[model samples]
Structure formats: C-alpha cells, structure tokens
Target: MQKDIYVVGMMVDERGSKAPDVQQVITRYGDKILCRNGIPSPSRERGIITLTMEATPEDYQRMEQDLKGLKGVTVESIHFSQPESFQLCENR
Candidate 1:
C-alpha cells in the first residue's frame, strides 16, 4: 500500500455548533487517523485540532476537502510521502 504521513490542522471558529459537524467529518476518516489532539480556547468558543494520519495522498486530500467544506472551519495540511523504511531506535 502506498502510504503517506499527513499532519492536519483544523480550526473551528464556532465550536458550539460546528463541533458536531467537524466531529462527523473526523469520524468518517477514523481508520486513517493515527493520532488526534484538540485544544479548546479559554472561553471554549473555538478549538484547534491536530491530526496525524497515515493514508494515501488521495485519502488525505479527501479529508482535507471534507473539513474545508464545513462552515466556520478552516483546514490545512502538511504531507510527507513516507519513506520505504526508517529506524526508530539508535544503536546501543
């Protein structure tokens, strides 16, 4: 499978009402998401979310598009075509 790593940033301007819609979009791409982190403002009227996703380029684009389609939501992404292999540990 051709997999790329994606870092998605989402801003919810109207958290109270837009949150449910944003949640739905995120849920639709649940399997592709590796990690999610969300931060709500002090007043809780806005939220910022970051997501790490492992999926094909097409899937990432689809997700980005879905999020962008929502009202009061802004989305952006950083994509890296994952290398074939990488070492996660250093030699002892």
Candidate 2:
C-alpha cells in the first residue's frame, strides 16, 4: 500500500513578479510541483500563482517551512488533502 498526499497553495507576490521570477520558482521546485497556473492582473500590481504539488510527508514538512523564506513571495493559503490509500503497482 502507498499513501497519497497533495498540497494545494495560493501564492501572492507582494511586489509583483516578472515572468523570469515565476519561471525560476517553478524550476527550483522541479518535479515536486505537479502543476502550476498563473493569473496576471490588469493592474499589474499583483499576480496570483496557484500550485499543486505531490508531496511526501517529509516533502510537505520541508516546503511548509521553506515557502515562507521565498523573497517577495507570500503564501495566501495552504490545504493538505485528507490521507488516502493507494495501490502500488510494481512491474519487474
């Protein structure tokens, strides 16, 4: 049996961000982040980024701490999905 974990987060950039900054953040997280979407504001003073990540217990713990340390970035909300059982398929 395997455990399934999900972390959903809404991110705000207090100072706003350029395309490169958002790209860097995605690159930094790499494969741990399963999906991400961005909404650009017409005001150009704010941007919203939503992230969905597949996390292990350890990964979740680490990101919770590390996300706050991101410069010019704020985490608006974080939701941890209820634990679920998963079937593991081993081929070999």
Candidate 3:
C-alpha cells in the first residue's frame, strides 16, 4: 500500500487551555510526524498548530479522534499522495 501525506491543522481558541494535552498527544505520535509548527495569537487568546505526517489509516484516525476530544479545539486534515513520476531532490 502507498503511504499518504497528511497535513493537520488545529485551532485552539482558549490559549493554553488545551495546548499541553494536545502536545502530549502529538508527542505520543512523534514517530509519524514529519514537521510541526505552532503560532500563538498576538493577544494570546488563540493558537494555530500545523502537523505534517505519514501514518496508517488507523493511526491517523486515532490521532484525529484524540485531538477532536479536546475542549476549545478544532482539527482539520488534508491528505494527498505524491505522483509516481515525482522525485525528491533531497533526503528528509
């Protein structure tokens, strides 16, 4: 089976209310994550986090479900596959 790339976006409206919990869950799935970036709102009332990963369907679903359970947090994900003819110019 071909592996897929997933870009997950999380928005938390309550600042640090659930950030630690979300970070814990992300850390648990660190092996599957390729990149992670988080930015806090200037007012510190909200935060935006992005995670790029490659994981099995089961693992992906589990992660999504875990994130969705957090209060004041909204999660969204996009999945795509690289074209067979495409080639990576550098190793990750």
Candidate 4:
C-alpha cells in the first residue's frame, strides 16, 4: 500500500456539544497525526482544527469516516507526495 502525507482541516459548527466528540475521534487516531492546532471562532460557537498526518490511504479513509460520523463536524484533507529531488543551492 502507498503511504501519504496529508494536511487535514476540521470544522466544528457546534463547539459546545460537538467539540468533545471531535476530540474523542482525534484521540483515537492520534498515532497517525503528526501535528495538531486548534482555534476557536470569535463568537465561540464554532472551532477550527488543523492536523498534519501520515498514513496509508486505508487508514486515512477510516479516520475520515470516524470524524465525519459526528454531527456538526466537517473534515477536509489534501495529500502531499514526496518530491523526487531537492536542490539546496538552486535558489541562490
């Protein structure tokens, strides 16, 4: 199976009740997550979270399903592929 590096964004529309559920799912898949950042909206009714993750396609879809099962939560992710080469001196 091919592995992927991803940046995921999660939105919580009803933070009061939904945030806890979101946290639970996030914790369950914490091993696949490399980094996490969360911010609350100005009104405090909603929240936004960003995650950096590395996993196989199967694992990614499973995690996505878990998060999407919660009400008022939406998940989006972008996959990043490895570069063939890096030239450090080219930018100069």
Candidate 5:
C-alpha cells in the first residue's frame, strides 16, 4: 500500500503550564515521528509544534485522539503524496 506524507500541527495555549505533559505525549510517539519543530509565541504563552511523520491511518488517528484529549491543546493534520516512500530500501 502507498503511504502518504502527513504533517501534524499542534498548538498549545498556556504553554508554560502544559508543556511538560505535552512533551511527554510527543515523546511517547517519537518513533513514528520523522521530524519535529516547535516555536513559542512572542509572549511565550502559546506554542506551535509541527511534526512530519509516516504512519498508517489507524496510528495517526490514535495519535490525534491522544493529543486532542489534552487540555489547552489543539491539533490539525494534512497529508499529501510524496515521490518517495518512508520505507527503507533493501540491498539487492
């Protein structure tokens, strides 16, 4: 099956209060994550995190569900085709 590239965006309000918990959740799913970038709002009260990953629909849904359960957090995701698959190539 072909896998699409998924980009997940997460926003956390009251970041100082919620960052530890949020980071824990993100760490739990670290294996599935290809790359991650996080930025804080000018006032440092809010944070935005971006993640690029490869996962099955089920896995993605599960992750999203977990994140959504967190208070003061919002999540959004977008997926699209890419020229390459996330799978590693085998030696011939």
Candidate 6:
C-alpha cells in the first residue's frame, strides 16, 4: 500500500440539491476516504461551498475520477505529501 497522503480541495454548487446529497457523497466514498467536510465560505458566492477529502494515493485518484463525473462539483486543488524513507526509530 502507498503511504502517500492526498488532500483534495473541492468546490460544489450548493444550490439545487438537498442537504442529503452531502451525506451521500461521504457514504459513496466510504472507508477509502479518511476525512470529508463541507464548509461554507461567505467570501465567495453564497452557493459556493468548500469541500475537503483526504485519502491515500491510490484512493485519491479513484475518488477524483468518481467525483469529477458528478455535476456541478469542481476540484480546486490536490495536495500530495512528500515521500520519505525512514528507519525504525527507538521512540514509538
């Protein structure tokens, strides 16, 4: 399994959909998605909402593909964690 962590920033049209759609997104993504949230941003259009989801590298690509197909939602940015090699440390 890949250890890389991916954080995706998303923007969705908050109109025309019921509140349950948000929950559906989370349910669809399921276990591969570690964290998901929809945050309202007043600085922009009232209907524009910010969403964030975190996943492993493999899961990120799959999740992105799925989300991209959904209407009215746009992926703003995908942040990837740097790869690092490490030896076992004495401290746990």
Over 1-92, each residue of candidate 4 has an lDDT whose tens digit, in order, gives 45678899998998878887898988988998889999976678889999998777788889899999888998999998644363213554
Estimated TM-score for each candidate: 0.86, 0.59, 0.82, 0.81, 0.80, 0.57
Better of 3 and 6 by TM-score: 3
Lowest-sum lDDT 10-residue window in model 4: 83-92
- In model 3, state the lDDT of residue 11: 91
User: What lDDT score is found at residue 67 in candidate 2?
Assistant: 60
lDDT (Cα, 0-100) at 20 in candidate 2 = 59
Question: CA lDDT of each candidate?
Answer: 0.87, 0.60, 0.85, 0.84, 0.84, 0.56
Mind giving the per-residue lDDT tens digits that candidate 3 earns over 1-92?
44567899999887667778988999999998999999976678889999999777778899999999988889999987766455434688
Q: Write the residue-wise lDDT of candidate 1 on 1-92 in tens digits.
A: 67888899998998988988999999999999989999977688889999999888888888889899998999988988767585323498
Best by TM-score: 1
Give the per-residue lDDT of model 6 (tens digit) for 1-92.
Answer: 43455566666665346334644664776765555565555454424433344455666676677666667667655565645563223476
Which ranges of candidate 5 are over 4 A from the true structure?
1-3, 81-92
Query: Model 5 over residues 1-92: C-alpha lDDT tens digits?
Result: 55456899999999988988889988888888889999976688899999997766777788888899999999999986655544444577
TM-score of 1: 0.86
For lDDT, the strongest prediction is: 1
lDDT, candidate 1, equals 0.87
- Estimate the lDDT of model 5: 0.84
Q: Please give the lDDT score at residue 37 for candidate 3.
A: 94
* Regions of model 3 farther than 4 Å from truth: 82-92
Q: Quote the positional error of residue 54 for candidate 2 in Å.
A: 1.0
* TM-score of model 3 vs. true structure: 0.82
